[model samples]
Target: MTMESATDAAPLRTQTVAVKSSFYLAMRILEPARRDAMYAIYAFCRAVDDIADDEGDRAQRREALDQWRYDLDELYAGRIRPRSAFLAGPVRRFGLDRADFEAIIDGMAMDVEEDICAPDWEKLELYCDRVASAVGRLSVRAFGLVDDGAKELPTAPKLLAYHLGRALQLTNILRDLDEDAARGRLYLPREALEEAGVSNHAPHAVLANPALDQVCAPVMSRAREHFEQADLVMAGLSKNAVKAPYLMAAGYRSILDGLTARGFAPPRAPVRMSRRKLVGALLRHAFL
Candidate 1:
């Protein structure tokens, strides 16, 4: 695949911010070239994820994911012609790992292949590892954690990336519980739900249960542990490299905190931080 300079990567930049302006804001800590690369990677991930989350036919979604898998194979095989313009630039420029990308795709395939309902805690962790941690591994490369612009990561920051990914992803899950329920998916483990007096595993039943925090307590606890571990692991990163991760963690933590403030029950309306609050959190993380 050929390299496209940051200026030529406008398509990727637009796609990424369109999906997640919050992430784009956090990513501003990086230099322009690195920021462009980060945008490209996020766009790639967003594309495959759209397949998994699409409301259209499942078969067509699977086909789309498969096409990307084929394209990724071409990416690693030095076949320049078939690669996507947005993905090819960053993957080539950053020397992103084939394994990380494949792991992410595998995670998307799991959603297509299996019905994610009433999973065990272990199963959920496996899903998180495949989807979130793998993305983290790839993202840190764009954040300048990799030396010489190579695919491999040193042990410490790599570990931190994985844990931070888990933390952020769990926060997402918590925030989206109602939304996911509407789509007929429930990520809270069956055992935990049962323990909290949630006898019926139906999405509506679980959604109506008054003891949501009790049911989701374990997962929230686990998310906090990962964030703590991320803190410990992130100590190894250089000052500049730590900024983006810090901003991410702090921002997401506030969201998690908001969830807690609401008694961990997802409200009828979606929760969001105001721009003023987000800016405040960003400043604290970036400076303090």
Candidate 2:
């Protein structure tokens, strides 16, 4: 299919949804081709995520996810369907890993299979890797860190993906505690819950527990460490190479800082970067 068809295949609705996302600035700042590729990836992610979170029947959701996997298989086998045609160019041009795409599907499957609550640290990290770092792995290629047709990614980009992905995901977990609890989901590790003497894993009960802040302390600390590691990795890369990811890290770190300042106590106000702060981050990363 022609690039025009591929571009058109990326639904306008998905682009609109992506434009309203927190990573809008990060994706927007890329060069045209790279930005398009990133948007395609984001659209793919958003579609599957919606299915995973849908209140529909589990079997239908699983069937939907399976259809995506079939489409991916088609895309890889040089048979592009209208639904996934947009990804063909990026996948070929950037040498995007098929497994990374499948990992994302698998990650969504985790949610479909069960609502995760207080998983152990290893399981939590695996969840983070599948859902977040796998996306980062795909993104680093689109960002031009790994050359086209490269056999494998370099150590630094890989590490950057590993650290930044987990950093961002953990921050999300901390920031969305109340929202997730409202949906009967809790992402805090079981070890942390136990360490904090939180016995109940019921989402609302856990949220109402006075020791929630204690349970969150280790998670916050871990997120900070991952952000620090991401910073260290970014410092070693070319400034031009890391501009988008740097902005993402900066934006998310600001949110994490806001969360820390807001504290995990009851009545936690929703934390977000103001438009002015977002503009400041854009200017700083874009031109400075």
Candidate 3:
């Protein structure tokens, strides 16, 4: 549904408060309009991710995800409900399209299958497309680039969105390796690791082996490719459009740098960019 359909709905103060408190600091780097839009987008994503990662019986989690998908379908059909009382404004303000939100649902649904594998390259790409690329699409909308009237390559924004998504997804895979392993989730493909003489079956063996560096090198290299693509995508956007993504890219790249410094070892804690660094990047982008 378009932005015009929900102009009359009551303001989403409670929802906005939660989203702003949670995501607003980083989002504040964005153009005011885009920042407002991003609150909606992030809230929607955070909600879905919480369902997938939160404590619950596997079946219960799956049911919640399924219900989320149904809510997504209804939202698209203009039957919007205040699920969290925080989503209405940003969703309406940004005029986010239904498909972008649904793609998130599709990605979360993958978690319910209970068989996390080291996906082949093709499968991994598809997974990234849904989970990460979809987020990028939503970001494009937040950046107010929907229906960009271009004479050629109308998909530049979409490509940028996908690249951003892929880069972040890769960062997550690396950062969560230890935790994911304990939970029986392996994101790095078995074939690639095996080719480098690493074993997914014995994750600790691979971690202990010096050859694990070899295994991570290719994955990091590919992640860099996507990162470069995302950079190119940013180059084609308005300066305002580039700000939030630039910070996000820099944050992800910092994690990559940290991984490289650790000889590509998995992180013991969540990899995060300092607030100072994040704000510094935005200030540079804003004034430069």
Candidate 4:
């Protein structure tokens, strides 16, 4: 029922760095202690996400996520899972919020539902808030982005996190449209698809539809807008805390740019930047 925190177990530094994601690399920009603690959160997220996406049985996945919630709650109560003991370090030290984690589980729960249909725009945004922004909020806090001599309100990091998270999630939706559709998971708004002249929700049909580009236009536009908003907040934050997020965003933004360059190409091949490009961005921005 309970997941362990970092304090409850030895920090899984190796496991965190093993994932080989842009975010994984960017995490290195943090000081050693914060980076280690972040691994716990990242590992937790990776586990839960895999459960929702990879588990064939929805009920089983739900049970696992629920167990994570219970673990998180138990963590707050001072009990610990030897495996998750590492999480407690960040939860207590960084003030990682409980609500955010719950929201993330709720988002994953959405994917497990029989109807993974894309609802209205508002609902889709809410989904992004849960799955992406919630994690962002926790990440920003871990990097100590919330305070710059208290010059700005505490909400600054959250604003940065939310916008960047939305931008990333929207870009992900665009990039994975064909794949997600094939999996019976369309994150795009039904309204957008309908407006684009597509009536059926089939992934292949959506990809083959001439109106695919049209339906995707608004999603693309919104992603760009969110990126800009993230930039605005990032501008207000101090350089130290912003570096990790900036580098991470750059990596993700490149995917959006790649998708745009390819005309938001279908699932045939995903629109991904090369490792060299991502690593180059990391080296270029990690210090700046």
Model 4, 1-288: lDDT tens per residue? Answer: 233324433455544443565577678668976786567678777777887886488788788889898887778888876655667777766678878888988988888776477578989988999999988988887788754223232778878878998998898888777667667777778899988878987666777777888888999999999999998888888877788787777888898888777885444466775567677866766566
Ranking by lDDT: 2, 4, 1, 3
72-96, model 3: which lDDT tens digit per residue?
6666566765573344455555656
The local lDDT score (0 to 100) that residue 24 gets in candidate 4 is 75
Q: Give the CA lDDT, 0 to 100, for residue 109 in model 4.
A: 87
* Maximum-TM-score candidate: 2
Per-model C-alpha lDDT, please?
A: 0.76, 0.87, 0.69, 0.76
TM-score of each candidate? Answer: 0.90, 0.95, 0.83, 0.89
Q: What are the runs in model 1 whose C-alpha is more than 4 Å off?
A: 1-7, 10-19, 81-83, 149-151, 264-267, 274-277, 285-288
Sorting all predicted structures by TM-score, with the top scorer first, yields 2, 1, 4, 3
lDDT of 2 at 64: 100
Regions of model 2 farther than 4 Å from truth: 1-5, 8-14, 286-288
Structure candidate 1, residue pairs in collision: none
The per-residue C-alpha lDDT of model 2 at residue 251 equals: 88
lDDT of 1 by residue, 135-241 (tens): 88888887877874664688986898779989988888888887888778888888899898888898778878888879878878888999999988777678687
Q: Over 4 Å off in model 3, which ranges?
A: 1-25, 148-153, 200-205, 265-271, 274-276
Residue 268 displacement (Å), model 1: 3.6
Tell me how far the alpha carbon of residue 70 in candidate 3 is from the true structure, in angstroms, after superposition. 1.9
